[model samples]
Structures are given as C-alpha cells and as structure tokens.
Target: MSEIIGFAGMSHSPFATLLPPARDGEPGGRFLADSTKVGAAVTELRPDAVVVIGPDHFHANFYDQMPPFVLGVEEATGFGDFGSTAGPVPVASGLGWAIRDGLAESGFDVSLSYALTVDHGVVQSYEMATGGAGIPLVPLVLNTAAPPLPSLARCVALGEALGQAIRHAPDPGRVLVVASGGLSHWLPSNDPRDPSVVGERRSSLIHGRQDARAFAAVREPRVRAMAGNPDAPVNADWDRWFLRQLYTRDLGPIVELGHDKLEEEAGSGGHEIRTWLVGHAAAGLPLVWDSYEPVPEWITGMAIGATFPVPA
Candidate 1:
C-alpha cells in the first residue's frame, strides 16, 4: 500500500539549458520554469528514494528506433555531449530488472548492452529538486530525441508501470514520480520562417479543456510538433491524454508553467514545469521561490505547482 508521494513533470531540456547558467546553484538558467521554486517540497519531504523519469537523447536525436523500445546502450558509446551523468549511476537492480522483464514481455526491445550515461536533464534537475541532498534514484530514460521512440500512449503506460515498480520496491520510505521535459519553446538563431524547431505558436491555452473546440483544428498539428518534426507544432493531446489517464482521472491541469522567451532568460527554448503529489501522511511542502502568477498570455511562463504525498 505504498502511496506515491509526488507525481511531477517538466521539460527535459530545461535543465540542460537552465542549470549550467544558473547563478550560484539557483534555477536561474531557464526562465519558463524554475526548479528551485517549483520543487522545494520534494527535497524537504525527504523521501527515501526517487524515480527520475527523463529522455535519452540517443533515441530522440536518431531515428532508427521508436520508444516503448529501450536500449541499454553499449558502455562505450558517447553522446558527444558534455552534460551527461552517464558514469556509474547507482541504479536499483530490482527496478532495472523489472523494467527489462516488462519491456521484453511486452514485445519492446530492451537492451542491457554497454554502460548508460546520465544526462543533465536528470542530474541537474535532481540537484535542484532535492538541493543535492543525495537521495537514491532509480533512473528511467525516455527515447525522446531518438528514433523509434516510445509513443505518448506507451510512455503513460510506462508511467503506470513505474508506479507499480516503485510500489513493489522493498525499500521503505515514500516514493516520488518525477517526469521532466517540454513546454512550448523556440531556440536562438532559430529562423521564424524556418521549420526546424516548432510550427505556428499559440498562447493562453491551458491543459484542461477537452472540448473539440478547445483544440479546434489545432490538436493534430500540435502533436506532430511534439513528435520532434521541427516543422510542426507540438500536439498537447497525446501527452495530455496520457497524463490525464495516468494521474488526473480525466481531471484538468492542476498546475501550469510556461515562458514565452526562455532564450531571453537562458537563450533558446521556452520552459514549462508542472507537479502532482498524492499522499495521506504527507507534510506540507514549501514553495522554493515566491509564488508567481503569469501575465495573461504573456511571453514568460510563471512557475506554479502542487505537492502532496500518497501513503501506503
């Protein structure tokens, strides 16, 4: 009966773009969502262990394979990127074993080839969320940037499985579900006319309205953009639908974070970070930065969130 203490989500690229530039260990790197402010309670709650969910650029950057199919990359393969935490991550074998067995049985390709490197999306955000308190984590990677990546439906299924895995975890203490990456964003040096990043931009849209008219004619295009076409707009439907099924119980957005010009704060890429925590014995969590409200349809997204624990 272990309750999932906190269920959270954010854009994976936020840490990569925001953490490095953060001033004095603050979440100053990104403008759209600030980890320091948003995840303050997670650290304070002091859960026994965390399950960090993130994307593996290898899957997203390339196009050979789609997701729901996980690869245990050869230890020697390098992402050529400097911000990876791929070295000797203390992975929970029980969790890995479960993920492996489950993926294999589900007809998803699961590989345990070489060593896996940790990306900044995990380490940096973890650092901010927990203030480097050194919490043990069972890291799961999403092939967000790779080819043959997992679909939105599959990822949500993975999340449900993750909840089960963590619940089954023998170790005691509360467990937190942390999903990181993506709010609408545009990069620097990006041509407004170029079709390499995102398609036409829309504002003031929240994640609650499921009415056909809410998305009107914009749903499908948004999803394709999210599929990383670079020439399309991100369809919030797939991700939102998955989250709605997995957590919200068909409820609408609980928290929203979005910034118009993330580049202005951290250069290229906007930011969004939202949270969901469910726990019976949970203590009140603190807000890291002063609570902020976004200007209606403004370019910048204010960081807002919710934190509650789920007890066993």
Candidate 2:
C-alpha cells in the first residue's frame, strides 16, 4: 500500500510571482526562503506523487456552478495568471483514478474533471513545494471562495476520507500532500453574491470561464493595485493561534470555529484555511517546522509549514 510520505501547508499569493520581494530579508523574501526549505524537505522525501489541496480564485470554478470539492482525474492546465506557471501540469492519472474511486466508496461524492484548469492557487504552491520538478500530481480543489461553503468540520471529515482513500489505493506509492492558501487576508471584491458587488467584475466572478481572458485582464489590475496597501488587514494573532494549533496537534478549537466566526476573526480570505485543515487531517501528523509573517505588500499573513517525513 502507498503511504503518505509527508505534508505541507503554505500561503500562496499572485504577488509572490508577479512582484517578489527584492531582498531575502524582506517579509515576502523571508517567506520565499522558508518555502525553499519546505521544498527541499519534499525533495528529500522523494515522493512518488503529490496531492495538492488548494482553493481557486474564481479562475476555474465560479458561482455559475460551484462544487464543494473537485478532483482532477485526467489532466490539469494552469492559467498562468500573475506570471505563475501556465500550460500542462503533469498528472498521475492512474493514482488519481484510484483516489476518485476510493473517495466515491468513502461517500465523498467529489466532483471529477477530465480536463481541469487552475490558476496560481495550485500552481504557485506546487511549484514552490516541488521547485517545479515536474513530479506527477493530483489536484484537489475546495470551494473556499463561494458562500455556503463546506463547514470546517466537514473539511476535516473530507481529509480523513482522503487519507483512507490514499491508504487503500492499490499502488499508492510514497505520496506527499500540500495544502495551499491562507494566513488571514481579505479580498473584499471577490464575492459576487454580495449586493455591493456589481458591474463587470461581478459578472466575471459569476461566469469567468465564459471569457477567461477578459476576466484576467480585468482582475489582474485590481489585485496589483492592492500591492503595499498599508490598510490591508492581516490578523497576525489569529494566524499565530492557528499555527499553534497545528503544531500542538490540537485541532478541536479550529474545527469548532465556524465559518462566520473564522471570517470575523481572520477575514474572508482566511476561508482558505479549509485547505490546511484538510491537509492536517489527511496527514494525521503534527507540524515539525513552521513560520509566519504578516506581509502587507502581499496583502496576506504569509506562512509555511511541513510535517516530518515518515520513516521508510
């Protein structure tokens, strides 16, 4: 049976690619350096494949038809938005199919895509963790952006199911799971369901797949405009508290924190922590090394963490 070799949870932002920090000492740069360390840890483990659990930024799934969870079975392509990787991403179809079947049997009812297109959410984290080594991967997307999201407890349960699926796969091989996104930041204009959200941006958020290029052209500028905005919120306290829970292997408080309470404490973008919760539950291991920084320039409380590799 294939065993989980390791797990990583990290923050991702377009600015990490589009507007990287100039020096290693800067917040973004420091985060990048730590990310490299995480990548090295992944390399040392020599995983056969990686499963990336991440959130979409409306670049793929939109309000037009959003599912709670999606697993890419056949292939995945990157949108290359904000200068992140574009074009074909290597996929482990055989293992992916096994995971799909296992999830179904486990009562997940996860959505499957023959051809999935993802943006920086999956690409950025995968590239950072693997250093773009082209290791085969399976992409699992969570609906963190849209409302009526799966509850935090549900996410944990989903992760547990995923763990069971991986363990039961016929040829699971050594696998690494990477959870991408969050640390507490806000993107006020992201939710189209809000009454205040109107005009072309709102339409794009709801139906971006219809004309992805146009939506990209419109959305990129707005995101760039927030670069270095001092007023942008990043709840460092909340971020640290969340990390502490992971390190201590006590997720009860986190799982009990409802979605509304999470938003109130960590902001809308903090919803991305759903991915981390999934990764933690799936790996079933306490974090060994973790770091955090509130980077206003990137408009997020940046963080990176990894669990110790399983013994061979």
Best by lDDT: 2
Clashes of each: 44, 1
Off by over 4 Å in 1: 1-3, 12-34, 59-61, 64-87, 99-114, 146-149, 186-247, 251-306, 309-312
Candidate 1, residue 283: how far the Cα is off, in Å:
17
Clashing pairs in 2: 2-173
Return the TM-score for each candidate structure.
0.52, 0.96
Tell me how candidate 2 scores on lDDT.
Answer: 0.88
lDDT of all the models against the reference? 0.40, 0.88
lDDT of 1 at 111: 48
